[model samples]
Target: MNKLKRRSDMLSKRNVIIPLIALASLMCCFQLARDLVDVEKNLDYCVTQAGKTLAQINRDSVFPRDIEKDGKRWNFVRKEEWTSGFWPGILWYLYEYTGDAKWKIQADRFTGYLNPLTRRPAVDHDLGFQVFCSFGNGYRLSHDPGYKKAILRSADTLATLFNPKVGTILSWPFMIKKEKWPHNTIADNMMNLELLFWASKNGGSKSLYDIAVKHAETTMKNHFRADYSAYHVVLYDAASGKKIRGITYQGYSDESMWARGQAWTIYGYTVTYRETRDSRFLDFAQKLADVYIKRLPADLIPFWDFDDPEHGLKDASAAAITASALIELSTFVPDRTKAAQYFKLAGQMISELSSRHYQSRDSNSAFLLHTTGNKPANSGLDCSITYADYYYLESLIRLKRLAVNQTIYDYLR
Candidate 1:
């Protein structure tokens, strides 16, 4: 009887404290609500803009590159580019949101364009990014048998890149000129592991699942610092499974934290915890989340590299990816206080991206605004990119799902 009375007292205290906390945050909460209205309006504009963009591309009778250039020019990229899947993935999200049959038709057509690539398996480690994002979303929404076969076959090809000795997939078989990184694995590879996990349970080889788990474990052991910031690359000795060194190809320096790479780690481990339900993965994700949150500016958008002295540019793609991951992360966090914090941070990121960061004036551009691609390489800096738009649409859909008390993973089911 005493224990029951104490529990009741604790519940009562929580009830009072929760409302007081909400009251304290009333202004911020009101601003967030206002931002959500803008999100809805922007999404409606995105659907129409995307439809027009697709129509123009189809009418041109040419394949499209991953980005929409200024003055309404679009480039065509080959199937081998790491960014190829993002275009179809955007169509899938548009279809998901608007429930418009035209978007569905466009998604099917665009997804079909990549179907032939699955038949000619290449050494590229980005098959997950190029195949899974398109076909995985397709199968989830449409249940098309053709999309399922494509994803499973793509998984088979991706498995061939795994080096059993190194316990991870080789990110690049070749290196830049004058550089020799033979057994290099990159943080971006973590995003690809989810496809392997999905393939294992959905009809592909079960070994794919094991390969993904091992890769993740190996990355966890080597890819992060004490602060939980991720290195862009970790070189390993293929013959001995020994560590070579951690380095950066796209970050400002070898020691600098690449913003997008950190986003990949956050999203990857959240998916890992979803697939395996491992407490270690969840705990690691939380730690990484805190590290990322601490590094953000007042707007919650991150620069291209966290350690760069000049804050001249921001990567909206990184912000979008991180926000989407946090939505899922909030659902898994066991601590109510931390869960609320994660959710609030996610809202802040989406709102910031939607408000001043997005390209509000450009109705002709199919891409989102303010994305920095490879600032270290001095290429595509502060330009709109396909993956940026893809993840932004994905994040918006995730927030919409949360509003309805649904999880993003439910779409996969």
Candidate 2:
């Protein structure tokens, strides 16, 4: 009788504490949900504006008729470019949420435009970016056979990029300045590995998995820097398995730091960490994140080049990439405080981009502005780039998906 009375008293205390905790958690969730709504509104606005821009691009009469590149049905667009896929990823997202027929039609048209490229196979490192993220994601969403076939074909092409002699993957086999760039870039190849893993599982390509692992092991050894920031390019003797050289390239150009590269390392190694569960990859991700967080500005925006004269100052793409990385990283780390910080930064940057950089006034070009493409290359400086749009939407979609389900890491682990 005394034991029963004590149990009842404990239960009464538990009820009080549980309710209080629930109330606090509920309030916190409400604030997060409300903030997510505001940010999503901004996303919708940007999406609509981007659609208008592309629609204008579709209608040739609005642009300067004399200009060949900007014409309606212009060769520059309504087509695929790496993961941009002529906005197929964006259209797919619209179709997924709104069931809009027009978006479906556009996505189908994009698939048609991309289907031919799969036949010849892109001999470059970005075939996965060009086809897999677009077509593969489309296949997952719609279960369309054509998209699946296209993705497989792209994987086949990606396989060719893997030269066993080097035990590493090469991207941009196309010569820079007519000199074949021999260095195996860390980011580009890692980006392709997921597709390879998919290929190994989907089609039973055992060698492909082995090849990817070898490349990853080599990358972990060669690409990582002392600060865990990672080298942009590391040259290896294709025959000797020795790292021949390393360069900063678009980084500080003296091996300083590149913000997007940092983001890429965080995402890439986290991915590798998932594949291998090697503490090294996870550790690398954490270290790069540390360097990244230390440099982020109040707006959560990073500069074009980290370690540049103005690091963490002017780049939206870096923020977008980092956001994507952090979302992925949060799942791998046991403690998600850092992940939450990165996610918050991503949210803040999304707001910041909408308020300042997103093209509210322009109705003819899709996507928010202020994307720096190949900042080190001096290409598309401060112009809207397609990959930025793709990744930004991807991050949001990731959030929307994860809200209902456990993270990728949950299943992965």
Candidate 3:
């Protein structure tokens, strides 16, 4: 009987092995054969607009005195949040499309500017955003060690802020007694993990990766409610793994879903799943995506907050971020039926934005209108933002790439 059972188990394993091997082979094919979208007009618009935007950031005003040790490069003007990375990230993406040496030059200049800053080794949680998209992408494309080192150093700096007691990274240096940020915000910590993932692939230290994963897991337990709509801030006892209280910093009360915050959670979880390949993370990602899509109107653009009290202008940033996340999530899903749905959803959002939301312009208003930066707090209301423009263009580029490469995205909506 034992021999028969062993023989049956061996047969079952052999039966499934070839199909798994074939699936692995398919993934390798896509990894090697990257199809790039050749949207010449839109590509030109994005590159030119990013250039124009960076040109406006006055070196003196945007950079402090002696940021670069050699009396060269731009300096960090203030305790800028992720603002420092926007230009380089845009430049790197521009290079991805145009292969322009000028953009590379500008990116190098921006890298130089990062040398002397208030957040050299990044003091705040926004450090991930500050470098991940820019330097992280830079190192990947250019094979530059300096860019890699800068990113690695930033991770080291970020790891310092990890509080073992809370199992999360504390953002902000006691900004508010009642609300000492990242200590309060799951969203803030979520944004930083992308860098850790990048570092892990590049042979950077594991400490950063461990810290980020720990925080992500901690945030998962604390912020997400039963319905899966995540909270904006989760207060925890720093010394003990205890839930002190939670607040809806920008959401409607404790339960109301803030559109941008939801978008953030969606994007963050997408990255989380991308790094870990954990089905639980994927489940979280899909749930957030479902909530986002259900709330979408005919236009596919989302309101600033799903539970907005006042009918305000649409927030293009939240929609753009969500579109990007959907694109990323679609790549990981093995099922074609689900992949096509998300692809169509992302396509719908991008199509609407490209055709009407904003023209492929090169001037200041490169991106679409209706972006509310923290509308729940009434900040940057109804104003164009640089990061929105950058990411919007990035989403298009990624979509365009998928279209170019005859990948699953090519067949998706």
Candidate 4:
């Protein structure tokens, strides 16, 4: 009876072990094939696209905010918009990627557009988007003191918007005439805190860092739902600095999860943790990422607003931003499995975005990707935005660095 049982067990082991070994071998081969896939060709195409974009921008001598094509011609933004710095930042990254002197020259020229912005006091919370993305990348690449000075000055300008009583940065000034609530803080302001943190670490005032931390803490307390979704804006009483209520300026509702708002929070908290090494910020980022991952579609991209059941349109900008943030967040997450999962999810989003439906075919626009920006507002719907292309290229560079066993830099700082 014992011998019969032993034989039966041995047969079972043989059946399982053989298949397991074959499966492992196949997985290894599959991974090896994926690893061997040449990314340089993809980079070449992106570089060529970028070159075309540069030529068009130069030919027109315009700063692109977003693009609109009427089939006959393409219309682009020329004002010093919030996203103006992204073009220069793209040029700097292209220079970094290809070692091209012309890209460097163009980067400098494009970066000059935001220099005036840094000197003046910022009227809105987007100084970081304008100054840091351009001069920050410039300083990172060239270590130019001029760029550093501009960034520091911009940080100083940004600090003026901080409200001590509210414990947050004022995102927008009073827009309505004799409005009851004059102070508004938005989720997007979270992305700007890095400018303050960067200034503190780089010989600017320590108060800037304190203001950033306070703003993050306040936003974490007020802006997020129990499920980690964020509100578009939180209005406050200007004189007393008391919280009025959460509102939706760019989302479907105050209760809805605005895709870009969530992306900004994830990126902001991850960066706050990176700068401060605070485990609390890491925990905050992880919770938000978990919610985002759980809610994402099979394609790993998200709709414009997670709660907008009727108008569930894709926001490529949000996906690109989230993926870039996730890749960075993966580096800091201590749980190995979770980190791997984050990276894999980011890779999935990148793969989907790289497809023809998203990638620019003819490079007619001064941008690289087609994205849904402010869909509810009917602005730049299914068009190419400069910041979307910036983050897409940024994420690609990060993935390439990982593939080549190189360390990725926090270039935004």
Per-model CA lDDT versus the true structure: 0.78, 0.60, 0.64, 0.76
**How do all the candidates rank in terms of lDDT, highest first?**
1, 4, 3, 2
- Per-residue lDDT tens digits of candidate 4, residues 186-216? 9999999989999998989999999999999
* Each model's backbone clash number: 2, 5, 3, 0
Instruction: Compose the digit string of candidate 1's lDDT tens values, residues 1-413.
Output: 11111112332432222233422333234356445546566677778767666766744223454343344655657666778888888888888777777778888887888887788855678889988888998998899998899889988998988999999998887662237676889999999998899999889898999999999999999999989999999999889999989999899899888999999999999999878878899999999889999989998999989999998888888998998898777767777677667777887887777774465346345556677788767777766778877887787777665444344465343
For model 1, name the residue pairs that clash. Answer: 65-75, 65-76
Q: What's the CA error at residue 51 for candidate 3, in Å?
A: 3.7
Task: State which candidate has the highest TM-score.
Answer: 1
Q: Model 3, residue 123: what's the lDDT? A: 58
Q: Arrange candidates by TM-score, descending.
A: 1, 4, 3, 2
Tell me the spans in candidate 2 whose CA falls farther than 4 Å from its real position: 1-39, 59-86, 275-279, 310-313, 357-364, 406-413
The residue ranges of model 3 lying beyond 4 angstroms of the native Cα positions read 1-38, 54-79, 117-122, 176-182, 359-363, 406-413
The prediction achieving the highest lDDT against the true structure is 1
